[model samples]
Every structure is written in structure tokens, then in C-alpha cells.
Target: MPTEHDQPATHAEGTDAAPLAGKHPAPPCALVIFGAGGDLTKRLLMPALYNLSSDGLLDEGMQIVGVNHGARETSDFRDELTQSLRKFAADRASTFHTSQLNEKAWNWVVERTQYFAGEFESDDTFEGLKQLLSTIKTGNVVFYLAVTARFFKPIVEHLGRAGLLKEENGNFRRIVIEKPFGTDLASAKDLNAHILSYANEQQIYRIDHFLGKDTVQSILAVRFANALFEPMWRREYIDHVQITAAETIGVEGRGRFYEQTGAFRDMVPNHLFQLLGMIAMEPPNSFDAETVRDKKAEVFDAMKPLTAQDVVFGQYEKGPAGPGYREEPDVAPDSQTETYAAARVFIDNWRWAGVPFYLRTGKRLAARRTELSVQLKTVPFRLFRDTPVDRLTPNVLTLRIDPAHGTSFDFNVKVPGPVMEIGAVRSSFDYADFFAERANVGYETLLYDCMLGDETLFQRADSIETAWAAADPVLHPKDGPLPVHGYAAGSSGPAEADALLAADGRAWRPLVDTRKKED
Candidate 1:
């Protein structure tokens, strides 16, 4: 599946690529999207690829071989893709005049489209896949295993046996796997080892879709590009950082899936930790794969391990006619799985010695919003003694990731009245205004990167383990009043969630509208 959260901006050819150096470039091969019949394939991957193809970026002879368990003809799949493109890709298409995309693109896409259905482990299916790919004669191939985690090992082994492993003249062969890589640290290692047997570490792409968003990418630029922020980005000047990925929708149809993976595994390990790494990673020597990955891995390794008391595990209780986590079908009657998680983590390093990194994610919280709030410490002494310093709420920088795309800062400012009163003001830098363009597809940019064989935004193998290493201690089964708090279905979250920070003398900022209001 495509990465979940990041969005990319569309740009004219010459003006676009120079600034994104070492980040994204086009590729020259066919992409085989497995599980093409699934939701991820129909909704995201196909639409994204079609948009990229329309943009004049996809190379000649590029093909997409979609693998599904069903018996849909190539025409059926093409029609589905055409409709999705019309719906999702239309905005980008119009902006770039990519709508003039004609039948040649459709014909190329449909002609290359074919399906092979059989047991993933069965060798009988290999011959069909091999024959279909023979005509393409492409050097690079990307196999996206959109299937469940259970099928990863078997598919890798079978693909290796099919002689698709390492061709004598092929340029590159890679595989992209989605998250929930493992339930815990030990299982993650075993899974990695198993997959590594067939695909080398360099050839594997473990996707955390959150990393794909445009705002997420902009975070790096926000910090390093400008001199105003990066110098004060450590313990000495900054007070703390809070990364929150909150969802207003509950597990409606994903009840069965939610039974196995709780908020911790689903949100914290991959998304929240990735955000933290971006917030804390040292400046890379250069933007190459090793340089970026090495810097991220260091931040992960320095994460302070949490004891039982430092963490808060909460399973949302039934609120106002809503069903609790345990009430969902196929879930344990008294499952300890937490739907809401809040914790304080420390990075024991020179740059961020004692500053606590607060991260939280939960379903059925207030409104759906993902944001990072960085609070810089205030000045030592206030010259205006009588005035309430509430106006000078420490400088806060917010990076909003979803439902809207933008960045806002809360800084102290002078009052305008002649009375000579002082107050603070909030100013924002919206990505939309900066680009003067409508938002681009998050998946489309990520798909373009994957096709180009760029692993900069994608998660590396070591970073995955390091993230789970920090998360494992709290997620592991432990004893105590492992509290579960409940808030109304449409409410933000449990009351205790507020208490989590209230006791520490902090509170969550009010949910601000990330998107511009339309009349």
C-alpha cells in the first residue's frame, strides 16, 4: 500500500526538481502492484500511478502488473482505474493540464494490466507471472506486497524461486512492505530476518506512509533551511515537543483488524516515532541514503526507555452509546489492548538531554488532526512586572499534517493600543498560500519516489527496530491500574488524557482548523 499521511506539491518541470535534489526523481520501469483488487490498490496506488503517468514523468514502456485473487479482466481493472483517476486525480490534472491525458496512456495501462490468482505459496502461480512480465523486458521492477503481513515471507520465497530475484542485466529489483512489521521487538527481528533471506536490506522498502506527506517533508526544510529555528532546536532553548495524531473516527469496519493491533502498534511505533526522528535527527552530512538513514537511526537509539510509571496506557471505554474497544467483535472480552496511548520519552543526548518528548494517538478523539507542537522556553525575567505573562505563552511552532496542510507559530507580540499593554499573537505560514496552488496527492509523490528508487523518505530496516525498541517496554504486558479512560463518542478523548499533562503543568492546545474555511 502507499504511505498513509504525507502530501506532495505539484510543480512545473524545470522549477520543481532543482530544489528537491537528492529527494525525488523519475524511474524507468514497470511497477507490479500486488493485491490490486484491495482497497489500497483501487483507491490509492492505481490513482497515483495514473496521475504520475499523465504528468509526462513515467518512462516509455512503463507497465503496471496488478496481482489479485479475483478474476477481473484487464478491461474491468482499467475502468476502475479511470473512474478513480477522474475523482482523485482531476484536481492535479487540471492544475498541470494533465487532463489532456488521452487513450494512449489508458491503452498502455490496460494492455499491461493482467491478473494471476492462486495460493501465494503455491508454485503453480509463478509461471503465469513470469510469462506476463517477459514481454515488458524492463530493467527495474518494484513489487508492492499490499497483502497482509502473513504473506510477506511466502511471496518473497516464491518470487526468488521464480528467478525474478536477481537478473543478470536488470537495473534494480525492490520490494515495498507496509507496517505492523511485527507485533513486538522480537517478532520484528524474526520477520526482518526471514524477509532478508530473499531480499537484501537495500532492496527492501518498509513504508510508513506518514513520512510521505508534504508537510512532513517540509519539517526538515523548516528546521535546517532557515537559520531562525535550527540553532534554538535543542534542550538549551526549547522546552518540549508534542506530536499528536488524533482520529475522530472509530474502528467502524476495521473492528477485526483493530482486534490484533492497538493504537500503540498502529500509530505510535511507525508514525509518531518517525515524527520524533524528524524532530530530533541531527543534520545529515549530505542527503544521500546512508547519511539520512544514519542520522535518523541515531535519534532512535538515543530514545530513553520508559518504566511502568512514566507511561500511560488507556483503552477507551464506552462513551455515550458508543462501543468500547473490548466490545468490538473478535476482540478479547477483557483485552488489555489500548485504544489511546500517551507517553513521555526522553532522548539521552547532548542536544536534547532532559526535554521530554510527549506523543499521543487515539481513535474517536476530538476532530481529526495531526500536529507537532514545539514550545520554546520563555525569557528569564519579564520587564513588564504587573502584566500577566499569559500573553507571552512560550514560542510555539506547530506543523499541521492533515485535514489541512500548514504551519503556525505562537509568538509574543506588542499590543496595539495607546495604553501600552503587551500581548501575544498567533501567526501562521500556510503551505497552500506559499505554493499558491491546490494540494497535491500524498500517495502520488510517494509512488513517484518509490518508482525512482529513492529511499530517503522511506523507513530503513534499523530505524524500524529502533522505533519498536523504544515502544516495546510499555506495550509489553505489565501489571497495575493500567488505566482506560472514556470520552463521549464525538469527544476529544478520555478526561484523564488531559490529566496526563495537567499533572505535569501542561495542556493540549485547542484543535485549530488546519484548512481554510470555505464560504
Candidate 2:
């Protein structure tokens, strides 16, 4: 086993002299992951830790212990993680992949990394954890449940029974839970109550990785920091807002899980709603952790509960790209499980009282776009009625969340001509154009905040419940006649989704690449 170094850990290259300015290591603590052998652990967590190490944001005294159900020695676990990290580094598709491994940083992360294997349901597993912690000598611990939802309550109960959750001597004991918090509103409340029975709300971090994205976090800065936007962020000036999360790939082999949790249950209440909360929330008085979270909670509480008529559901059909969702492995031949979800909802608060917020997410769509577009009300076109222009273009501010990391605004500009003419153009900003940092897998910031006791980016119990409540009626509609329409594998979505907006005399913006020129 490797031992902690007395000297400070080495900073990564590119600087080659000192750590990044204004960045420091988080507090020293032990991180114990429950599903240590799962794909999430190998694919995201290890790379995130490696990135934190590369940035000198992981303390030298930090210890990483992975607890999963299996029989393996600590050394073997370390070796397995080493292989996984190297593989992730070499793969170009992975979010945190680099051309090569930074051995200096990788070694530092691995030195603190260890493993424990025991059944999550057995009392002896947590007891073994207690004994292991006694030897580790770290006063602070963060138990990360990366396992399936079924294992959550039992594992928490075991931790409470073992008394590992008790904090003293000015030390901290906390837990980080992955989402799919519940299937519906009632279950979400029940889950929250059950989890809180053992741990205080302060000690629980209900993580939503979507909040960790740079562009997602920048929503606040763009709205609050910029003097150009705050005054115009209301129903009077803005028309309906659209939030779209499309994917080009279908359920990629997790058919069993997807069958149980369709697109709405999978994306809406947590990921897509978080995006809505960011774009639609009232400005917080300050940027304090609780203050920002409270603002988000208010936005969630303001959502008008959905109904069957307000939402549209769809499943992907065969197209140019690949097989239909039903043909995917492990799925039922006649599955009613919807692969697409779209809804037009309203926020009942004063600031956003009559403006509709449109949300849609689905698999195997025309593009892999996750975007929020705020469309301003169109200007009067009486001046251009005779100038070869019928109506003025609606001014739109688009925040692209995935693949493309940036913001862009569209408006009309006068074209050069002898006669009066108008043309639409865009002004855009992309992170890659101005920033030199590598892209992260979205877990780095969430994990770092947990170690430092920050809840600004995490979800709270009330927020979670309200989000679930907003989506409940559509999730389990009392009306059985609600139909699931079909769109091709590479199309935008169902025609009904288009109809949702067409009914309002509006249209969806093209799902073309933001950085590239559109046809």
C-alpha cells in the first residue's frame, strides 16, 4: 500500500512552476464510493478525481476508498482503477479524456485511493467500513451512493446502524446521492423522508451533475452579472421560452433501465428542470449557497403542475441511422414506454406569470443539442410592411449546454442595398474560443463542493419534491387516452411536439450546430 507524502503534491504541467492562480486544494477528507465497480465509477468518478488532482484541487491528505459488493484486496482494486484511468485518458470520446495520462497527477490520486468490498445489505459490511476508517485516520468522510436506487435505503440504514454517520471532534460525515430520486411525487417525498430520517439535510448532497457544467453555472453570471439582461428577464418583454435536450443516440444497451424510466422520468424532473430553474429563477439577493438554492426552490415551487393535454410523448421509429427503440436489446416488442417527452408549462409566480416555458427531451433525435432559448416578443413591423420584409425576426438569446459550450444572440441587421432591406445575424460566444482549460465530465465540481461543504449546485429535498410534483400528472396520467406519437430515429421529434408550439403561432429554431453556419 502507498503512503501519504509529507511534502505537497506536485502540480501538473503547462504551469510547470506553481499551482493555478486562485485555486487551492479542497479540505482533506475520505471519499467512499458505494458502487465502486460500476460504469459510472470507472467512466466518470476516477477521471474526475484525476482532473482534480491535475488541477491541484485535491488535498495531499485526502483518501479515496471505494466500497462495492465483491471480494478483492486493496492492491487489486488499485490496479483495476489504474487500467480504467489510462483507458479513459486514451479514449477521445470521453469527456475528461486526455491524449495521455499525467503520471504526476494520476499517481497522487492513486496514492490516496483504496478499495473495500462487502455486501451493501449486510451489517458486517458497514462494520468492516468502521474498522477500515479507524485505521485511515481521516476525521471527515463522504459516502457516495453511485448504486441503483433500490440499494439506497438499505445502505443508508446500514451506515446509521454502524454509527459511521455520527460526527464529532469538529469532523464532518456526509453523503452524496445520485439522482432518479423517485419515480413520482409521492415516492419522491417518501424517499426524502426516509433518507432524512438518518442524515440531516445539511449532511446530504442530492447531486445533479447538470449543474456542474460551465455553461450551466454561467446562466447566473450572464443574467445577474451583466447589466444588459436583468431588466428584460420578464414576461412583459419575453415570449415563450424553449428548453430542448435532444440526443442522436438511442438507449445504447441500457434497455432494461430505460424501459422502467422513460425520457420524462429520466430527464425532466431533475436534469431538464434544473436548466429551467436556472433560466427562469428570480435573482437571488446574494450568491450564498443557501440563497441560490432557495431561489431555485422558489422556481420549482412556481411550476404549474402538468396535465395530459399539456404534454406530448413519443417513441422513435426506424430511420436512416439505426433500429427503433423497440428493437433495442432487452426491450419489449410492444413497449408503450415513451422515448420522447415534450411539454409546455407555465410558472405561476408574478415575474413569469403568463409566459409559457416549453420543455422537450428525447432519444435518437436529429441533433444532440441541449439548449435553452429565450425568445423576445417580435417588434412591430409596420415600418417594413412595404420594404420587402413581412415581419421582423424575434430576438433570441440561446444558451447551448452540450457539445457546444456557449451563448449566442440573434437579431436583425439592415442589409446593404439601395432599397430598404433586413437580414438576421447572430453574435456568439464560445468557451473554447476564449478559455484554454480541458472539458470536464461534470462530476469534478460537484465532488469538490461536497468536500468543501458547499450546497450551491446541489438540489434540496423541497426542490426535488416540487420538481417531481410538477411532472407527476404526465408521468402517471389519469387519462389513459394520451397517445405516444412516433418520430423517425433522426428526426427532431413527433409532429405533435411541433403542434404544441404551432398552436401558439411560433416555431422551433433549427437544431443545427451553433458554431457552424446553418443552411
Please name the candidate that would achieve the greatest TM-score relative to the true structure: 2
Task: Compose the digit string of candidate 1's lDDT tens values, residues 440-498.
Answer: 45576777777666678888778888888887777664665366655565566667767
| Clashes within 3 Å, all models in order | 7, 0
In model 2, the clashing pairs are none
Highest lDDT: give the candidate number: 2
Clashing pairs in 1: 3-209, 4-209, 6-212, 6-213, 7-213, 7-214, 366-492
Q: Model 2 segments beyond 4 Å from truth?
A: 1-19, 93-97, 385-390, 513-519
Instruction: Tell how far residue 121 is off in model 1, in angstroms.
Output: 1.3
Any idea what lDDT model 2 has?
0.85
Quickly count the clashes in candidate 2.
0
Across 319-425, the per-residue lDDT of candidate 2 in tens digits comes to 97688999999999999889999988899998899999999999999899998999998774567635533366679999988878899999988889876777788
Candidate 1 residues lying further than 4 Å off, grouped into runs, are: 1-25, 83-108, 317-336, 388-391, 436-439, 478-481, 512-519
